[model samples]
Target: MQKPEEAYSIRVIPDVKIVNKGILHTENKIEGEEYRSYIFLNFERITNKGYEASPTIRDDTLYYVNTKRNSLVMQKEFGQPEELFKLGKISKYTFHDKGILVIGEDKTDKKSPFVASKLKYRFDSRGLLRSRLSLYLFSHGELRKVVSGDFDVTDVATNGKRIIISATKEGDDYGLGDLYEVDVETGELKRITKGEGTVVAVAMNEKGEVAYLGHREGKTPWSTAKVILPELGITYQCGKTCGNHVLSDLFDGVKDRLIFEGDVIVSPGQEGGEAHLYLLSDGKSQKMTDGKIVVRSFDYKEGKLVYTYSTPEKPVVLYYEGQTYDPNPDVKGLSPQRVEVNGIEGWAIISGENNPTILFIHGGPHTAYGYAYFIEFQYFARNGYNVIYSNPRGSQGYGEEFAKACVGDWGGKDMNDLLLFVEEVKRKYNLKGKIGVTGGSYGGFMTNWLVTQTNVFSAAISERGISNLVSMCGTSDIGFWFNAVESGVTDPWTEESQMKLMRMSPIYYVKNVKTPTMLIHGEEDYRCPIEQSEQFFIALKMNGVDTILVRYQQDSHEHARRGKPKNMRDRLERKLEWFDKYLKK
Candidate 1:
């Protein structure tokens, strides 16, 4: 254990820009306190105002998205940022061999901002969808509007003349998107992919061949996601290894996930819990990175690869440059022992037999717990608690069908997997004073459900969790669609469907919660909504159970990750105090 004063301190690398001369990385120090960014020039720190967080290199020039100004800027060496395109809040800018592609909004469009006229307008972390993203092509110092309409484009890649994008409303609006090719000169859009489910990223080779990273038609939205080359009839979906990077990291040094060198494709793919850059050439793929490591982001040029990578035990030390740019070297904690019992893969940090145990469940019922550095989990391990976490059913990194395993089962098998994993860990470790459970989002829902199902856990904390399915459908931003697709609720308004939803809801069995529980939710959480926690807290009180509802204002569903620094520190302290009071005894 270490001093508590320096406990909530977090250091991260937000943007890592790779240039010809050297590597440019922005490091944020002292999280939740005074924020300071340090820019490095080839492993050495430098400062430049015009240089944005994540800048792209195009013909010895830099191009970046200025979110504050809502513009795309061009900057040469030792020059001020020149506004190239001032579209509404430019989120992404791509530099291809042919030209530059920018995506943002059209401020000239006369429409009420942040207001959606549809059933599913709002989303978690991303609030109301007031307007769709507008795509523009900046070629030869001239800006041209290429795409803006009913279709919401998720990802795009270009060859200057041909633009390949992924959008949901291109044809049969089943919320499933297709790969559409847009001819920039003619302003024509054509769908290329056939069996489409969900497309996360897209890429195009020099030969104008398009490839998408996603799954085909599946049982639900949480389908097996992979990179597919329809022309080559090649799908990069793997069961033994993760087809893409699915875990969250401390520093997401932005660069590129998909790289096309001629017909050869280099992409980030995860093996087990760690991610590696996989090169796919001649219709065959092989990993390029060595050792057990987690690559957050990477960029390549002139036969040299620059990356920001980390592990549970350490930080990113660029292998090519032979330099270490560790964000928090001094802030080290307990390491984990990877384990798998009954097909449920997980990690367990064993301090001692006397220490209590806390089972950490990941959100996304779709996201997996992998080889990423988590400060909260590290703190829990440092505070004399043996931590156990795993990717149960409906988790990514385990192929497509496995992710859809809990499509209609929700808390059924996933809950059982967690319970079973924890029991096995407890027995294998042979020492546990008390057991606690905690998670956010979907994990929060499981926390509430697990407590009600078994008395194995002495305390539990649910963050941004779901309790009532019937209310969530109408209240949450993505509730209507998420519930229908995830929970198999075809008709939510029907009495039969309502009964089925309630039967699967945690609030329906709140009376069965014997554990001392804590509900941590955001007042402005639009995904699960704050009402979920309030309802569960009220029911727990009515049943004479010890429960507390902690709410954070000015925060959405991402309170734990990207919330206010002070708020993040306060959250950690609150969880520690709650578990200490209930589980320490």
Candidate 2:
């Protein structure tokens, strides 16, 4: 007997191409075009090692710190890629006219082949290994130490005389930080912000006005904008008062204007909707792009805007001067219908009538499902399955209160929201008895939790899920901080906290699960770890429930989304097969 044909092939899905800190390639041209078309440069391509950070350009030379090779490369005038220096485990870099500032950990101690850097290792009290990120300044073929400290810098911006950095100090609450200014001439460091949420994406205008994006307590999206003048100690909100828009990626535009992409939540209870470019000038805000299209990374120069645009049915394309360049033309397009389920928002991409319905949940618990292209969802839809997805409470893009509603109550209201969504979809489509469920990460946790809580669905697929929160707190990366914050536990060592974690975990109620389950995980996943799936698998086996576990060796926590091409394909095939055996039959 021969194996059955797979519904989707990885060959057609294009390689991952991301443009971070993109620079305008003025001299590049499209094939068969005589005129020079504006093209963006990608810092790194996704291969076996994964993509690197964005590149910083200075004086016709492009400089990028490759986290994969643990080195920095310089390309002068779009020539060839050349190795400039070896800086191990770099997290961020900034290019100056006089020198380059590189920040990373010194990871020459680890002996494991799977360990990418020393940052991957975790300490007992500090959770993940907290290495002192030293700052080095390279100038005139020489490297000099600028500063060395134990701070996790999120972003950095410079203004010739001063450097502004956003960082969270040791022992500070997670997702909350402060801003600091450093004088270059005297090495004088000054704390700027006074515990104002998680400050990120700092930018300075030519007139010395500073702007940043941050989120305060009880906020969902990072849309809070603050403008500060250090000389006067004056700070105020720059854009329109935050309502339904979640802002991201702040850039200094021409003449005291700031440009950013705002994900606007259109549906009442939905987490996200379409994203549009917005311009803030003179204390007023205006939408730049059409409200329907989604804009990713964009840069404005001399009134001309260069941006990458995509939609639910479109791949990422560069748009400028009546020319559009599609990076991945081979990937198939899809059309998902916008669904409003009892004041909640969702999307459905139905393939065939009477097909088995699968409800997909997104991860992040903080992240939202938007009107963008998702290859996996498209694959399932094309393979004769009704794919449904929704953004419940605790998801971003909605208001701050709605997003924070599920923070401390993890398997509580958010799970109720998902159950309501499934019931509404089943009733609307008349497919109550032929439904299935699947998700990854936090979504995976919810899948496991849902199956154990109820037996409504015929099949369940959980990937990289957290079955036991007590073990998860000690094993996964960032688990120490994340588990405490999400579970509302001030002390993990206490018995009360332990019991709270156990109550929220799915493994405690595994014996009640009747739906057939398939567990998928990456062997090297430090985020959730393979033990999570293993524990759940063992529980199901002991209960005599039908369950299968699939582990990918060469992948990590992000295997389903950003793992190797072959492993991603194999994981998807396993999911399709499991659902077919259970739901189709």
Indicate which candidate wins on TM-score.
Answer: 1
- Provide backbone clash counts, one per model: 2, 0
User: In candidate 2, what are the lDDT values of residues 1-585, reduced to their tens digit?
Assistant: 112123222111111122234434321111221111122354123222232334556666666555457787787774877876775477567665567776666655445343325323653222345455566667878766565555566666665545776666532434456667765545456777764475645665444455555544322232333443444454444223222232111110001123322311111111256655555554444566664454555556445566665566664566765566664566555688777765567878876558898988877777667676666777777667888888787776665566667777878888888889877776776764478999888889999999988887899999988899899887876676677778888776699999999998999899899999999998788888789999999999889999999988767776765555567667777888898898788
Q: Which runs in model 1 stand beyond 4 Å of their true positions?
A: 1-8, 14-18, 29-39, 48-51, 96-99, 106-116, 139-144, 171-175, 238-246, 249-256, 315-317, 321-324
User: What stretches of model 2 exceed 4 Å from their correct place?
Assistant: 1-57, 62-68, 77-82, 112-133, 170-175, 185-188, 218-271
| Displacement of the residue 415 alpha carbon in candidate 2, Å | 2.2
User: Per-residue alpha-carbon lDDT of model 1 for 1-585, expressed as tens digits?
Assistant: 633335545556666656766676666554334345555666665454433455656677766655456677777878876888676567677865546777666664444555556676666665666566667777888777777776577678876556787777643234567787877776578878886477767887767787877767643666655678876788774334434445553434343356665777767776557777877767677778866576776666555666767667664444456666676767565678988979888999887788888999888877777777777777888888988899998887776677788987989999889888988888888964899999999999999999889999889999999899899989997677778778887878899988989999999988788999999988779888999999999999999999889989877887886676677778888999999998887
Candidate 1: lDDT of 328?
A: 70
Give each model a TM-score. Answer: 0.90, 0.80
CA RMSD, predictions in order? 3.1, 7.2
Model 1 residue 237 lDDT?
A: 42
Candidate 1 similarity to native, TM-score: 0.90
